[model samples]
Target: MNNTNTVPLVAILRGVLPQDVLAHIEVLIAAGFTTVEIPLNSPDWQTSIAMAIARFGDRIQIGAGTVTSANDVAILSQMKCSFILTPNTDPAVIKAAREAGMQTCIGCHTASEAFVAIQHGANALKIFPAGELGSGYIRALKAVLPKHIPLYAVGGITPANLAEYLRAGCVGAGLGGDLYRAGQSPEQTANQARAFKQAWDACQKR
Candidate 1:
């Protein structure tokens, strides 16, 4: 986390390739994003993550997403990943990630899951399928969660609707398909990243 007041938007490059990943990340950083994740399911994901970290780690936070196992944690730890994003809360995975000195943003959909993730040492909570669940659900969750817990809305998030989640108390969002899609050109990514950055800046002003 950069720790500035700027909303920490995470660029979830779910299908980016190793050869093209850096170009996309360059434009994203230029548009003011400081955090990015390459899902393990993507082609050559480990290589892409390593490349990103080697090139931009000092300038931004780079990590792996859709992580599920402790074995994966060990590999990422060796690479010095700044954080790990999971699709679901798994205590073992969380414990491993924490022990490896990586920030954990475990995904959750209910209060029970949220609390459980927190107890296991998640640094943040990602509300998966957030657009489907809507911001009202996030507002309700925020009410009972510790005030310091940062909530991030993921899935189906876009520039047009980011403010709805923010006003409902989410600190940021994980931008997936709306932010980047497989085969898109670097120019396309630049346009979308700038749009998202502008949207986040606008939301903070309100």
Candidate 2:
């Protein structure tokens, strides 16, 4: 939602504890990642988000993922979160978020869902479980989607295969476990983040 076309990588910290979240985020920031999401399903996720925002709001865009309800959107809006990402297309949620002046990246698997999400005011489309659908699937979807609609590939995304998704027309990606594991040291996570950044930079160069 934050003009991801310029910096397309979203670091997803699904299981990070609030106590360690800031450190993890710092590592990601050091590696040049400007967007991060903490899934609502994680333990004390809200606290983690609030802490991140309080500490680094000006430096990076913090967001919440796995959002399902309009209430969730309202909470994020109050927090001034940068964006909301869902694993499925929910018009109500998307509308609520947009009305609250928040950016949304709704999930969609098929062309129909993609169209519906766009109609509902989604800022971008997240091609979820993208590893299973593959880049070919994305290319097919792109044939019907508006050229300006940003498409982000999530789930099973790795630095090695990210280029394929980009070539297939994905504007960006949401990197999860491949970028961070709950127990990994900050240095280890930073190394992974840097590797992905390098891959994305190389892909852009081409």
Compared with the true structure, what per-residue lDDT tens digits does model 1 show for residues 127-206?
A: 99999999999999999999998999999999999999999998889999999999999999999999999999898787
User: What tens-digit string does per-residue lDDT give for candidate 2 at 1-206?
Assistant: 55543378999998889999999999999889989999999899889999999999888889999999999999988998989999999999999998998889999999999999999889999999999999999999999999989999999999999999999999899999899888888998899999999999999899
TM-score of each: 0.97, 0.97
Off by over 4 Å in 2: 2-6
lDDT of 1 at 181: 98
204 Cα displacement, candidate 2 (Å): 1.5
Model 1, stretches more than 4 Å misplaced?
5-7
lDDT of 2 at 161: 99
